[model samples]
Target: MHIKKYFGRMLLLSFLTLPFIQGCAFFDNYARIWVASGQYGTDVKDLIAHWQDYNISYAGLSIENPSALLFDTKIDGRSITYEKWVPVTDENVLMTIVKWL
Candidate 1:
C-alpha cells in the first residue's frame, strides 16, 4: 500500500513538472509572439501584419464571440473555429479556450 502511494505521488510530481519543462521550450519558440483577446474584426489583419514584421508567428487570437468567417479557413495546425493557432507558445491555448474558468 505504501509503495503504491509513493508511485502515485511520483506520477503526480512528474505531471506537474512537465509543464515547466515544456514552457521553457514554448517560450523559446514563440516568446516573440504576442497574445491578444478582443472582438473579431478588421483588427485581426492588423495583428497579423504586426507579427509578420517581426517574423513572429501568430500564436492565438481569442475573440469574444467568433463568427463563421473566422473558421471558414484554417490558419494553423488547427482550424480557426476550433481556436487552434499554429506556432503557439504551446498547447496552453487549448486550456485557455476550453475552460475559460
Candidate 2:
C-alpha cells in the first residue's frame, strides 16, 4: 500500500518536473540550433540568428520575422521596412533572406 502511494507520487513528479527542465532558458540556446536545423536547414548554426529563436541576421542586420516572405528587419536595432520590395531594394534584408533560404 505504501509502495503504491510512493510510486504514484514519483510518477506525477517526474511528469511535472521534466518540462520545467526542458523549459529552462539555459537549455534554449543549446536547443535552438537543433530546432533551427529543421526549420531553416542544417547551416543554421553558421547564420546569425536571434538567440531567442530563428530570426536571422548578417553583418549587423536582422529580420523581424524569418517565417514571413514579406517582413520587416532591423539594422543596429533600428527597424527597416519597404513598401512592396524588401529584398529588391534592401541589400541587408536581401542577404539575410538569401542566407535563411
- Candidate that scores best on lDDT: 2
Model 2 steric clash pairs:
none
Cα lDDT for residue 49, candidate 2: 40
Q: lDDT for each of the candidates?
A: 0.44, 0.50
lDDT of 2 by residue, 1-101 (tens): 99999999999999999888876665646645334456545443343343232322232234543544433334346555434332434556556566665
What are the runs in model 1 whose C-alpha is more than 4 Å off? 27-101
Tell me the tens digit of each residue's lDDT in model 1 across 1-101. 99999999999999999988787676666757556567634354463333332222233345222221221223454433333433323334323333331
Model 1: pairs clashing at backbone N, Cα or C within 3 Å: none
RMSD of each: 13.8, 12.9
What number of clashing residue pairs does each candidate have, in the order they appear? 0, 0
Global CA lDDT computed for model 2: 0.50
TM-score of each predicted structure versus truth: 0.27, 0.26
